[model samples]
Target: MHNLRRIRKHLGITQKALGDGIGCTQGNVYHYERGQTLLPEMAGRLIAYAARDFGLVLTYDHIYGSAQLPPVAMAEVVNRG
Candidate 1:
């Protein structure tokens, strides 16, 4: 299983909220947690949302978990909570 669900739950955000951040639907998030991987753009957007809104640092590897995702550069934000 991907860390998407875990991270979202940890952040206390709903699928619809996360999907809105990444420009997807809640159903898409539902499918992503099952097996599908997020597009690089969407992943980056998620990372940004996590940082800007939730003050949580996130990365492609963090989001993909054990999935074989290529490395992508993204700025991480230190938790301000």
Candidate 2:
């Protein structure tokens, strides 16, 4: 579950419009925005769209509610730092 609603609102778009952009139903967008369920593909598409159109980096954690990195990715990031 994620706070997609907040993002959508921030972008001044309706649920139906976001759904249309994401290829989901308005009901699905409503539920997803309410943190009921969010598909990864949808999340990815949303992030890409936001980045491309609005220059926003809406991260999966920001939307999906889990910002925790996997151990391997975290380790790699840490090593680089």
Candidate 3:
């Protein structure tokens, strides 16, 4: 499971705000945060948009454990970008 809700909240952003920034709806954000949906590609986009638009940097280690899976690595690239 991903800690997207926790991390986004820790970054001081509401679900709606995160959704708005990522071109998705709040329900989609909820699904992502709750692990009901798995949008790995969108997750990368969201992470990048969060850092570039909201100045919130979320590393792969923050969301997933240090497993270094392909998706997690992409998330790292998004976080760094």
Best of the candidates, TM-score: 1
The true-versus-predicted C-alpha distance at residue 72 of model 3, in Å, is: 21
Query: Which of the predicted structures, 2 or 3, would earn the higher TM-score when compared with the native?
Result: 2
Which parts of model 2 have CA positions greater than 4 angstroms off?
A: 66-81
**Candidate 3 weakest lDDT stretch, 10 residues:** 68-77
Give the number of the best model, judged by lDDT: 1
Tens digit of lDDT per residue, candidate 3, span 1-81? 777776665556678877887788899988887777545777687679757765556666656654332222344435433
lDDT of 2 by residue, 1-81 (tens): 577887776666678877776778899987776667677888898888666655556787867675532222233223323
Q: Write the per-residue lDDT of candidate 1 for residues 1-81, one digit (tens) a residue.
A: 457887776666678878887789999999987879767787788889877776667877787766433322232212221
* TM-score of each candidate structure, all chains considered together: 0.72, 0.68, 0.66
